[model samples]
Target chain A: MTPAAPALPPALDILGIAVFALTGALTAVRMRQTFVTAAFFALITGVGGGSLRDLLIGAPVFWVRDALVAPVCLATALLAWFTPVRWWQGQLLEWADALGLAVYSVFGTMKALSWGVPPAAAVLMGVVTACIGGVIRDVLAGQPSILMRPELYVTAAALAAGLAGAGVVLALPPALTWAIAVAAGFGLRGAAIHWSLHLPAHGGEE
Target chain B: MTPAAPALPPALDILGIAVFALTGALTAVRMRQTFVTAAFFALITGVGGGSLRDLLIGAPVFWVRDALVAPVCLATALLAWFTPVRWWQGQLLEWADALGLAVYSVFGTMKALSWGVPPAAAVLMGVVTACIGGVIRDVLAGQPSILMRPELYVTAAALAAGLAGAGVVLALPPALTWAIAVAAGFGLRGAAIHWSLHLPAHGGEE
Candidate 1:
């Protein structure tokens, strides 16, 4: 059987992997962990959600098919470990994270669609793939997960994925649908970050 | 088509759920978290690995089909929260943990076998399903996972699962095979806990 082509361009996937690795390394740094620990964190953050998604969907050769993702994660981890604080405290990292979120969300949805999952399930899978790494990172780092926070994270992902799925249903071109999804995800997430917008808190006492 | 009967006795499954839930509640207490956090942890610990396994095998109505699991988890969490530490500590908790590890390991292996997974994969799944909850709990509590430690934890589960798989290959009675596997797992874990025997630590530079 012919090998399946990747759902997204190599460049965007690598960028997303690198950004996630940077985030994981940053988390390890905050925890005052060693270099190896930081690398392990970065590796998991880059691939954990996607690994789970593939395993659930019974994708063949789950990790091996993505040649660029691991190397990018490793490089980013090393860079994060060696870079000075002043260099990292910039808007570039934030932008990279937004881009990563968008790319990963779209890619995740496309993979689910390829698996022939229903549209609703595909959208849910997209959100899970985009947010699960961060959720795992927070949980492992002993911080409250973003899911537990009154945040717009899941909502943003859902909106992005819904748009993409709708595009698919409407028979829009795949490239155009992906572009629209990525843009929407990035736009909403960037706005949330800029405006400090969050979901309304529940009133019940803990 | 009629649904396949559960592989084990309903009471045993319920007992396993309760034990895991109790362990999770105790962990939450150690972390000094609120009741909600305790409940959440307990529920996840009781059901997380099994839910994951079912999803991977494409089992329908994964959590909904298991009626006893959720209630047992909730009940055990409530019990642990209310019970005095003096009453719940020492041998009582240890015994419960051993039984839970054994039962859950066998349950996982049986499920994997029914799914026609290879023996090695089934054993791996057994160990993962039995122990992933504790790993998740430790990670959430910001401690090293049991798997990362030099422990006999996974070894015991693997041995038990291997024996069970062999029994199946030889066409031995299923109940007898399950009993042997459970005994091997629980016995080894109990002995290790009693004797404080563990795998040797990796030598680190001073």
Candidate 2:
């Protein structure tokens, strides 16, 4: 595979890491954990999904090789530590998370495709990249993962990943494909957050 | 750096996978999930830790490459599905888990060291290898992870990993080192289970 998709712009990538790291730090902060715990939460949450994806694709782990990633996560954790919880509440963080989720999912798909993972598996990789970190954060924090709920969180990620894979198969312009994919994922997640949207619960039946 | 330790015997490795997979299946069974869910749980739990280790150490994922591993997990899940839950209740599973944890941790350390991971990190790799599968199982099942408790679980893994690392440094015979490391880990975990041992809870303080 000769680079079917270009790499994510560094600015958006760092923004994604920061946003995820903030959410992680907030989780620990809400739990009244120590600064160390918050920092660790930040680092793991920021890196978890991408790390898993890289591992599965037989590539070197991204955060381990990237010097900036850990420091960004740590700085985000510090920012969370010093700030009042109320200041970071409401739509702003949700919007940022939505953006991060979309961009990260698309980027993950592109990376996997470039690595020659089958397109179907690559889409799954994108979902893993977008969502596993939050799942891990919830798991570590002893909270119910959003994946366990009827929420549209994972569905939104699947949409992004699926669209990215489709774009690659169609041989669309990479930039246009990525932009559209990100917008679609972000819009879905944003709508879910705004409208309190969710999938129907699993009906108890045979 | 050379591979200072030999691989875990295949029989013992398969046994470890089977025990871990059984625990994963049992978690889903008790939750009243379907066979498909149980199988997924078993497969994930059996492979989760080692997969993470391989990814971190830049090695090929073991289960993805090995034909026997997935089939073993699936078979374990099938056994779990058909058997009455009570048949698996009691100390039997715990003993098996303890054995699996000990052996897996040692094996993980050996693999990481062979892969050029630093000794301290390799020890952590061992703990990750032993504990991560169970952690993932609990997370997916929405139960509180054993890691969050002040239990001797991780401590036991650390002991095994640490001892394995020490043996490497001391240039001891691999077989003797592995035997002692596994025994020490199992002994500690076993004592903890029998005595309901736990580390003291973190005191609420500034």
Candidate 3:
């Protein structure tokens, strides 16, 4: 079965990579790491999960196959280093993070579907591809994974992938499905960040 | 191609599981975690990767399918908690670890080959299954992975798996191949742990 490509504009992909790289650099700054270490972290955070997924699926890794990603990552790291804005500042970084989440979710879902994985497995791949990089970054930086918190992060990605997969199953046009899914993810995450929305605490003893 | 089953008695499997669980518990104690946390860490470190591999390969997870593994793990954890000897300093624990590494590597390779994976991929799977549980434990504990260290752990597993795969290709008797492979792995890892052997550091300044 031919995998349907998502209707992602090239600009969206580039934006996603750049934003994730910036987040990585910002995380490094918080950890008081050197510039080279920051850059290395940024690159890995931008591409690591996709690389692992590609290796597992026997697909040509996009980072190795295409030269554009590396340069974009480096540029983003440089930008993060020189920015007057503190990495922890709420507004700009949050928006960038939301955008990255949306785009990465779509990209991951599309890639997994292309590999002929079943819809459920493909949705799993999508969530993993979008979130595992950040999880790895957090682990390396010795912080709890965002998923461990009562955040809507994984939930947002899951929603996006589920919608995309549903659309595919319903025979919707690929472009329309992708656009709606990405919008749904970005919209939900953006609102959560803006309003500080979160899941209710379980209040159980740890 | 038929995968080779280890000639080592089933008792070794029980012993390996117990020792690894003890190691996991000791490591958790070193972190000064709570009992529930320690037990969770022990269980995951004892079985997570192999369980994941079984799920992927459509095998009944040994822990879930067989009645013995859970009891063995629970007993190991209890022993670690109550034993007068410091778990970390126990010589039998060291021997059990070596034996576990050998048996698990052989078992992982055989399972992969049974699923008809390519030999190289089977070898990779073996290394992943044998060592990934420990990696997951270290990551959760905020320690660097064994793979990041200049260690002989993964290398030993890979070599054993490769030798076992070669034996399969050469049509050696399954039992003989398993015996030799297990010995090769156990001897290498035991010597490394005994002598503090490690790979030379790489990625020096160019």
Score candidate 1 by TM-score against the native: 0.59
Best by TM-score: 2
Candidate 1 DockQ, CA atoms: 0.08
DockQ of candidate 3 (2 decimals): 0.08
Error of 3 at A126 (Å): 1.0
Q: After superposing candidate 3 on the true structure, give the runs of residues whose Cα lies further than 4 Å from its correct spot.
A: A1-7, A200-206, B1-104, B111-127, B141-172, B175-206
- Candidate 2: list runs displaced more than 4 Å: A1-43, A56-58, A62-135, A142-206, B1-5, B204-206
Which pairs of residues collide in candidate 2?
A: none
Which regions of candidate 1 deviate over 4 angstroms?
A: A1-6, A65-67, B1-47, B54-110, B116-206
For residue A83, give model 3's deviation from the true position in Å: 2.0
Deviation of model 2 at A54, angstroms: 3.7
lDDT by residue for model 1 over B1-206, one digit each (tens)?
22363466667777777788788877775555545456556866776677677766566424333445555676776776666645666798878888788878887877787877787788777887788888776766667878898778877877787877787787889889888988998899888888977988768995
**DockQ leader:** 2
Listed per model in order, the count of residue pairs whose N, CA or C atoms clash below 3 Å is 0, 0, 0
lDDT, each prediction: 0.73, 0.86, 0.72
What TM-score would you give candidate 2 relative to the actual structure?
0.62
Q: What are the clashing pairs of model 1?
A: none
- True-contact fraction for model 3? 0.03
